[model samples]
Target: MAASKIAIYGAIGANVAIAVTKFVVAGITGSSAMLSEGIHSAVDTFNGVLLLVGIRLSQRPATAEHPFGHGKELYFWSLIVAVLIFGLGGGVSFYEGIQHIRHPEPMRDATWNYVVLGLAALFEGTSFFIALREFRREARGRPFWQALDQSKDPTTYTVLAEDSAALAGLGVAALGIWASHRFDMPALDGAASVVIGLLLAGVAVLLISQARGLLIGEGIRPETARAIRSLAMQQPSVQDVGRVLSMYIGANEVLAIVDVNFKDGTATGEAADAIAAIEQQVRARFPMIRRLFIEASEAPVDAAATA
Candidate 1:
């Protein structure tokens, strides 16, 4: 629903159009490089559609069955997208490129191929810039790779990955088309395709790593842990926290479980009610945390707590 999401849809829309055009041109030209590039773009279009669907479904409101919300599902779908990109786009392209390199073929009307590649590059460049703009906006005051690492916003991650891949693919297409045109050596085109395949594989690895972290319920940074510690001490019944554990359950949801030392010899019934109250307070203060459980701990005083 955000502006960046709309921009991603535009990128997706353009890719579908470009993929169709590229496929027709590649078939007409009988160029293996062009065919590989077409397949690459076609896969990209599919990836974009998958991202859009993931983004949409991930936004669904929480249900009774999934009281924590349906956020982790996004990570699962994103991981699947990554696998598809690597296997379908990268593997297929690598195989086709090797075949072309071994057995050269005559190409017809290289001009149209070059023209389409250039035009598609221009469009894809625009889309990449839009994604970059959003990335920069959200990643303000942080290193680029760090921002990419810490960004929990699904839309940013999905669109950023797709557009980055799309723009790079465009570059590869252009280089291959130009090389094949210049020397009339189809092998250069094939080599370019090999490079494109590697790029896709690299991007796939990135997506999968990030998605895997999310699926495993990785927690926020130590700073967030510190914030929670400070808030826990504010509860009058809680003397000090003993053991704390927290993991991110969604973009804005953390699953928090705490072991705290309440005042010694406090009334058992009162202590039970007090622990429940502390849990509610923690959840209220940190709306991002969906679940909180407080258990009593008998331990020595330690000012510092880790989550």
Candidate 2:
């Protein structure tokens, strides 16, 4: 139902079909690149399943032992998926490529390779477009790289990256197959596999970095923090707002803690009322902030200025 689910399901379905076809063709034609592509697809299939599991686990309600809920489960699983992509998908592909290079086999008729690759391109392209569409909708006109950098949802982007790499790898495999047969040199097939491996490794590294940041605790945007501080300062009973600390506890949920210094002569009841008003305003503007705590304090103006 969700956009992320749609992209991930589409990818899994396409990869399952393509992987099976690729392995069959690889066995028939002995193309190293085909086998590598099959391995890549298989890894993607498993990764999709893991992401779904993460989504389910992340929805669990908060418990006494884990007051923040299981929101971080998704980040943990996403990190695991990145590691698997690097180890099984990238490492195995590289090793297979090196072996193929070391022991070159006689080239066979590549007509079937062409057929399978063309079909794979079609399937991968369809999945890629689906993911790209969802990402664009989420970006809302933000530049691609900038939106991707600021994105908190991992499912949509992870699927997009995997599909992008699949499309690129298919192109490389096709080119390598064509060149090896045309030039009577089979080593090019192995070279293509190596390139695919490197591509997967690079994507895996980027995903790992993002997952690590989320799992540890990534905060809301600086602009959003500043806006919240301004809201607090607008309250008549408030002197200043200080140390507006915030972190994303889930893809669409944030936990924020704000330190506020009330007016010098404000009554306790009035300060409490102001705190309630500030919380209401912040939450109204930013529904993603599921949990907000405002602490009354006597903080320095300089400190209050820095959200």
Candidate 3:
């Protein structure tokens, strides 16, 4: 199966288990942080399912109403997931935290909180490890931040981000629990919930920013664009390669528009042949390019060289 799917499934399973355990413990101990953690895990679980559904929807073939295929479906759903995280997870946690702070309740049976948190940490840590390893494999030799920025496939990155946030939130929750128990300040538990909510909100904002770029048709990497331009210039009858615009239509799928300056006074038949040759070479060289549109024009400088 796809790496994204595997990661999603793993996260869903781990989060579901964690969420159930956390809710049970929260009910038993009345720890505000535990309840917040439960909500966070539940949101992560639902987000995983949404991502899977988005992937499936994105695989649909092109139709008259949507000629670019359903590839953008994934981006749309990803945005929705971000909104949900912010609205449902972060917003609710913040409200609960404030309520707890105003009317602080004594935490009972604190031992169960530790047991549940330890188990949750184990499960969240495993999921995070899987996501990090998969992301590392994808990054190859590129810097982790660079690879993350350039990745057109949002699945792995989204999962990685979610799991990373989960681990961090778990730490905060643990710390809050410990502080409250040691200092006999139950308000610390509520403060920890507030922190978790803020953390989730930050993650949601990052996801929204990434998804917005994808939705607005972000261009291909500079290196890939340059390679495509070089490929176009290799055509026999081509005089210069002009602007070559490209955008990702799906994970590993690109649509390119090549503007070419043909040799002056070239015959129509020869230009046609050159265009065909350019298309063939481009598709052959970059299989990820699902569609190519070549336009032959009059005198024009190579935009790439000037840039």
Candidate 4:
């Protein structure tokens, strides 16, 4: 299976189990943080399902109305996931925390909370480790942060980010429960929920920014763009290379347009041959470039016009 699918499946299984256990434990122990964690897990489970749906829809063939295929469906669903995280996970947690703060109550039988928390951590941690490994595989030689910025597949990175936050939230919940009992201050539990809410909001904002960029047709990496321009400039009949426009149509698919000016008195036949050779060479060099359009011009094309 694809990395995205693997990450989503692992997360869905872990979250569904964790959410059920946490909700039951929350009801038994009446721990605000536990309840918040349950809500978070539930939302994550639904998000995973949505991501799978996105993957399916994104695979649909291009239609007359949409020549570019349904690849952007993945971005659209990812944006929805971010909004749901902010609204359902973050908003609910904040509200619950405030309510608990205004009317604090002593947690009953905290032992069960600890047990459930420990088990939840185990499951969540496993899923997080899987996501991290998949992300590392995608990163390869690049630094993790740089790879994340360059990544076109939103599903994998979104899962990694969510899992990272989930692990952090679990730690906060454990601390809050311990401190509330150790210090005889019940307010700490609510504070933990608020902290978890803030963490989720931060993740959501980051995801929204990434999804928006993808939806708006983010260009290829600068290095890739430069390489493409160089490929065009290397053509024998080309006098000068003009604007080279490149955009990612999908994770592994790129669309590039090369504008070139031929040398003075270059025959039409020679220009055509050069254009074909350039196209073939570019595609051969970068297999990800699925579509290449070469335009022969008498004069160097305007950069501003291309932009």
Best by TM-score: 2
Candidate 1, residue 173: Cα displacement in angstroms equals 2.6
Give a tens-digit lDDT track for model 1, residues 116-227: 8888888778777787787787676799888877787666777777767767776786788688778988887788778878888898888888888888878867876777
Could you tell me the lDDT of residue 307 within candidate 1?
13
lDDT of candidate 2 vs native? 0.89
Give the residue spans of candidate 4 off by over 4 A.
299-307
Tens-place lDDT per residue, model 3, 38-110, is 9999999999999999999999999999898988888888898899889888988888888888888888878
Q: What are the models' TM-scores?
A: 0.82, 0.93, 0.91, 0.93
Off by over 4 Å in 2: 140-143, 299-307
Q: On residues 1-307, what C-alpha lDDT tens digit does candidate 4 reach at each position?
A: 2887998999999999999999999999889999999999999999999999999998899999989788878889999999999999999998898888888989887898899889988998999889878888877789988888778888998898888889899999999999988888888899999998988998999999988888888877778878877887887778888877877777667788888888876766667778888888888988878878888778443445555
lDDT of 2 at 13: 95
Q: Between 1 and 4, whose TM-score is larger?
A: 4
Poorly placed runs, candidate 1 (over 4 Å): 1-4, 137-143, 234-237, 265-287, 293-307
Clashes per model (N, Cα, C within 3 A): 0, 0, 0, 0
Relative to the true structure, how large is the alpha-carbon lDDT of every model?
0.76, 0.89, 0.87, 0.87
lDDT of 4 at 220: 79
Worst 10 residues of 3 by lDDT: 298-307
